[model samples]
Target chain A: MSTTVDRPLRADARRNREKVLDAARGAFAETGLHAQIEDIARRAGVGVGTVYRHFPTKDALVAALAEAHFAHLADIVEAGARREGDAWEVFAATILDSAAPTAGDAALCEIIAGHPQAIEAAALGQERLKAATGALMGAAQRAGQMRDDATVQDVQAIMCGFGQVAAAQRAGAQMDWQRYLTIALDGLRAR
Target chain B: MSTTVDRPLRADARRNREKVLDAARGAFAETGLHAQIEDIARRAGVGVGTVYRHFPTKDALVAALAEAHFAHLADIVEAGARREGDAWEVFAATILDSAAPTAGDAALCEIIAGHPQAIEAAALGQERLKAATGALMGAAQRAGQMRDDATVQDVQAIMCGFGQVAAAQRAGAQMDWQRYLTIALDGLRAR
Candidate 1:
């Protein structure tokens, strides 16, 4: 009887947490770092106290989002690595897929660019991303499909740069990030 | 006698204006957009009234600085165009030179990334830069030295993206922008 009662309660708590995160992601995507906790709680169909129970603060919410983003990126990299294809094709596709702008991208960019401390909170996810990307980079380099001089760090910087360019475009700058990505991809090709 | 007196006053005002600009540039580079006008006045060895007299507001000061940065980039592009070298070499040199990080680069990146309205104030300077870079890009493309698909706007976006990467590096991210630039340049190549 105790296990049955606790199990439902735990499931309810987990569902509430997921709802809050989903609402917060949408809010942050639209308004960026200035998105309010109250708005996110209302959107989640939860009281503000529930939001505080899960995240404690706006920074905590953002940190959780950042961790999720890193995990998503790691999954992309791992999937690309698993694909049986030309090394260069796999590497380039991974780069393009990871860097392609999405609604959630703006919030990740803001967290990376403005909230360095939040990154610390996402270290486990970041480490997973780093390991996944590093393995892919090594395979591509060993196959002579990508420049040997480029490091995993270089790829991360390029992706981060792409995020900034995309954010700027969304903010009304007239430029295409796909073109920019193409040029960068060419630059990464092995001589 | 009246003309002579007015000439000296004008000269003094111009000198004060230059000093304030120099101080503001240093301050903005070190502290970004959050730098205070009073601190800039103090660094310039002028009264707060002097800075206000010359710039009126922080936005105006930043706009002036942005215009100056654009003009400087225009000068660099024109000088590269005038050089006697392989069109590709000249184009690459110009891009690298312009994108090379400087103390003032951080402030320029902040303005370009954060203040779109200020760009309108620097339209004339931006036009000159566009013309100069366009001519260089045309020459390179015509010589079959650079990728023909790229537009001048593409080049500008890449440079702006590079600026953001450099700024982030300055903020303690361990990344080498020179390597990033090299990869981008390769992407711009005709091959």
Candidate 2:
């Protein structure tokens, strides 16, 4: 009887946590790190007190979001590596797919570019992402599909560059990333 | 006799103005737009009153710098186009050479990325830069030596992206723009 009573309560807590995280991600993506905790709580359909219980501060929430972002990126690269196909195609597809803007991507880019403290909190997830991308890059290079001179670090820098371009476009710069990616992908190919 | 006396005073004023601009460029490049005009006046070996006499305000000074930046870029592109060489080579060299960081580059990137007011103040310079680069792109594409699908705006976007990567590296991100530029150049090449 004790286990049954505790089970529903624990499940309710878990569901509420997930709702808060989802709402926070959306809020952060749209309004950036300035998104308010009260607004997030309202969006999550939870009380402000519940949000504070889950995350004592906005910084803690941002760190959580950063970890989730790295994990999502790692998952994408690892999944692409697992698929049996042309290594170049897989690599290009992975990059292009990941570059596709989701609601969370703006938040992820902000964390990577602007929040060093949040990144420190997500160190483990970043390591996982680095390892996953390194393996994929190695496989692509070995298959003689990708340029040998490029490092995994180089790829990361390029993606950061793309994120910058995307952000500028969103700010009304009147340029698109599709052609930019095409040029970058072409440059990445082996001579 | 009065004209002769006025000539020397005018020349002295011109020299002082140039010194202030040079000092401001270095200061702004190192420390961004927040660089104090007092410090710039000191660096230029002039008084704060002299700085105010020349430009009146920080915004006016920044606008002047922005205009100079665009004029420099325009000169580079127009000069490159006039050189007798492969159109592609000229285009690539102009892009690569401009992408190379100089003392004023950080300030240029900051102005381009962060200051809409400065850009507006330099509208005529920006228009000249656009026209110059557009002619170069058109020549390269017409020669069948550059990719036709790309636009002058695309080139501008890529440079802005490169600027973003460069800024991040300066902030201690472990990446370099040399390899990034190499890859970007490769991408811009015609197959």
Best by TM-score: 1
The second chain of candidate 1 has a TM-score of 0.87
Docking model 1 quality class: medium
The single-chain TM-score for chain B of candidate 2 is: 0.82
TM-score of 2: 0.79
**lDDT tens digits by residue: candidate 1, B97-130:** 8766342466777666546877888898789878
> Any runs in candidate 2 off by more than 4 Å, and if so which?
A1-23, A34-59, A102-105, A113-117, B1-23, B34-60, B101-104, B113-117
Q: What is the C-alpha RMSD of each candidate to the true structure, in Å?
A: 4.6, 6.0
RMSD of 2: 6.0
Per-residue alpha-carbon lDDT of candidate 2 for residues A46-137, written as tens digits (9 for 90 to 100): 99999988888889999998877777777877787777888888888877776775323566655554346888888887787777777778
